[model samples]
Target: MRVQLILSEALSGLRRNASMVVSVVLVTFVSLTFVGAAMLMQMQIGKMRDYWVDRAQVAVFMCREGAATTTCTGGVANQEQLDAVREKLESPALAGIVRDIRFEDREQAYQNLLELEPDYADLVTADQLNETYWVNLVDPSQTDVIAEAFGGMDGVEEVRDQMQYLEPLFSALTVATYIAVGIAVLMLVAAVLLIATTIRLSAFARRRELGIMRLVGASNRFIQTPFILEGVFAALLGSLLAGGAVVAGMYFGVDRYLRERVPFVTTWVGMQDAWIVIPLLVVIGALLAALSAGFAIRRWLRA
Candidate 1:
């Protein structure tokens, strides 16, 4: 009997403030979607870091003809200078860290440059390219020490860490994730306010019935249960839709399009990740709605 009464009251409250309920649902849906997107982007960043960071190498670029670096003041690195630098890299000081070392002569470097940027291939000559020693370190975290050891050395123009090239990309994604989270937070606040407004309006519209119930010895808990349930049901519906949207994004958007296009990415988000995020979103939605309804009723529906 209590369950039926609560359900009927919740249904009546929802029907009474239909537009506000729709607003709450839509707001919660959009908010949770942002939350899901931010989470997925963070996951992608982690996967990319875990996969690619270990593959990163330190490139010790030798001086090229006409280069104007302080370390390259001796015109260009001669073959003797190049051999000396290679010997230093293979020295005992870097024994455990140096896993492999590959040399890129001017010709080979220029060819790689052309392959990377064919349109500008004819614009630059071979002498303009630097001879590079690609140093594969056992651990990527030792990149700074390697760079410091070789950067100011004779015949070396600069020591380039491959991770530098990847940092900006990951940083941009992190910023995007933060932006999504910010928007989600704002939208969630809007959802809460809308829920509170809807509950207030529902309570006001049914003031006469509540007054009769109060005269018949209805407790405050009994009166508040239906209003809280109404908000919880609406928010739950929105969260369910948001969860579905998140799963669809991961499957169709990330897995299908992104993974297929970027075949090199071995670690991609799957349904399991989506499933993990969905339940949390549902719980958050339900809590937001219930808390807002309870607060609104306590403030406005005082006997």
Candidate 2:
């Protein structure tokens, strides 16, 4: 009888204050959406780090104009130095880490450059082109070791891994992710406080009933159940809304936008990522709401 009464009262409160209920839910949903997006962005960074690590290019840029010795230091890699570098890269000590080595002469690099930007053809002539090695490592993680080994070598003016190119982009994403997550956290705390306030108002409205119950044989558990249930239900609804919004945002907007428009970000988050994030967010939302409501009720009970 007590359980049924509590459930009935909970339903009545929800129906009576539908607007407030909706407000609580909407706030929760928006808050959780931000949380989900933050998680997704973090995952996206992890994905990029993983994918690029395997494909990082080890570059061996030769020197400029020739000097006394055909050395590459401040000059282009001569035939002998280039050949020796290739042999060292192919050696057994490095073979496990060396995937494929391609040599691009000054002329080839210029031709490729001209192909990319014909208008710049007049800017740089093939004669001034510098020969470089496009070294593909078996694993990108080995970049530090390989780069250190060959960077200061006799013929190499500079050794650079293409992954260095992605540093700026990753750094930017990291900053954005942190900022977004921080904002989401601040908003979530606000939502929690609002929910507590709203639930407290509802409790105040039912103060007469609570007072009557206290005078009667009602236990603390009996009086608190309905309020707890109310908070739980509100949180659950909000989570569903937020989770759905996140999935839609990713599917129609993020996924399609990236896949069709920007090819680079596609590899960052796959379909699997969405599948994983949704359920996780839903769980988070439900738990957060229930806990918030429980805390609110306990606070009101003390009063």
Candidate 3:
């Protein structure tokens, strides 16, 4: 009987302020969606970093004939210069840092380029490609040391760390994630304020019933439960809407659009990611609604 009465009162409150309730729902929906997107972006960055960091290699490009770089003073690297570089890399000083080393000649480099960019394969010739030593490190963090050691050497034209190319892309993604989080924070604040306003108005409209109940010796919790339930109901609805939107984005936007276009990114998001995000959004919405409604009602309920 008590649960039935509380439900009826909560339903009455929602109907009495239908417009405000809808506004709260919409605001919560948008806010939680941004939160979910920001979280998924962070997860994507983690996956990409894990996938790429392990495979990142340092490329030591030896000088080729007719190269324009100042480091190519000898015009091109001969067998003696190439042997010297190999000896230095295999030296005891770099033994612990360098895990594996592979040599790629100009012809091999041209073939590899052709495989990646077949349409423009004819534009590049073997003579234009530099022989390279590919060094894989046990720890990719020591890339700078490796680069400094090989760079400016007699036969080396340039030392390029492949990981450097990925840093800017990840940094941009991280900035975008932060921006989304900021927007979500603002929207959540708006939602909380709207919830508080709605509860205050509902309390005012029902002041007479509340006054009579207080006179009859109703407890504070008994009077406040219905209003709190009203806020919780609206928030839960909004959370569901936000969860749906996030799931759609994960499926249609990230999986269908991005995965199909960029097949090379093997570590893409999936439905399981949404499972984690949905529960968190639901909890946040419930807490925001409950706290705001409870706080707003305290002053109005006082004797």
Candidate 4:
């Protein structure tokens, strides 16, 4: 009997202020959607970084043709110095740290470059190229070991690692995601405020009825339960709608679109990850709505 009464009152409250309820749902949906997108972006970035960092290699460019025995002069690598660097990299001192190493001759590098820019075929002859020792490590973090071994060494011109290139991209994406998440949080705060105002207004409009209920000795919980339920319901619906749209976009749209166009771009936050995130979004929405409604009722009712 008590449950039936609260449900009836909640439905009536929603019907009485349908416009306000709809407004609340819309705001909640937009805020939660932004938050969800930012989280998905962060997950993708983490997956990609882990993939690349683990599999990345440090390229040690060898002495090009007609280069001196000295090191790093005019961007050319020499033969004797190249051998010294290779021996040290392959030495037992670095055995566990270094997984595998491959040497790329001038012709191979030229062929790879051709694959890169087919139109720039005549940019350079094969003889003008320098061979490089591309080192794939078991541990990418042990880059300093290779650096310490090869730095200022003979025959090798320079060593470039993955961190030099990929760090900047990750940093930029992370900053952008943080900014997006920040905006979503501010919008969520605004939604909470709107909910509070709407609840306060509803309470004011029903003051006479609440007074009668109190005079009849009804518990405060009995009167406030419906309002709190209304908020929780609105939040749940809004979050579900937002989560549905995001899941659809990620699975049906973004994945297909990116795969069709940029197949090389990889992401780990797929359909499975979406399932995990949905519950979190729902919980966030529920908490926001319930807390906002409860605070408004408690404070305003005190007066």
Query: lDDT per residue, candidate 2, 96-180, as tens digits?
Result: 8888988888789988998889998878887676678788887777888887788667877777888878989999999998888
Greater-lDDT candidate between 2 and 4: 4
| Candidates by lDDT, descending order | 3, 1, 4, 2
Flag regions of model 1 displaced more than 4 Å: 95-99, 119-121, 125-127, 260-268
State which candidate, 1 or 3, has the greater lDDT: 3
Clashing pairs in 3: none
TM-score rank order: 4, 3, 2, 1
What are the lDDT scores of the predictions, listed in order? 0.90, 0.80, 0.93, 0.83
Tens-place lDDT per residue, model 4, 1-303, is: 999999998888888888988988999899998888888889889888988988789988776766654675645655566677778888999899889999999889989989988976877878777788889898889898787778677667667796778899989989989997998899899889988887887888788989999999998888888888888888888899989978987877677676678666665578887887888899999999999999888887688
| Backbone clash total, candidate 1 | 0
Location of the lowest summed lDDT over 10 successive residues in candidate 3: 294-303
Q: Answer with 1 or 3, whichever has the higher TM-score.
A: 3
Error of 4 at 74 (Å): 10
| TM-score for each predicted model, relative to the true structure | 0.87, 0.89, 0.93, 0.93
User: Which one is best on lDDT?
Assistant: 3
Q: lDDT score of model 2?
A: 0.80
- Cα lDDT of candidate 3 equals 0.93
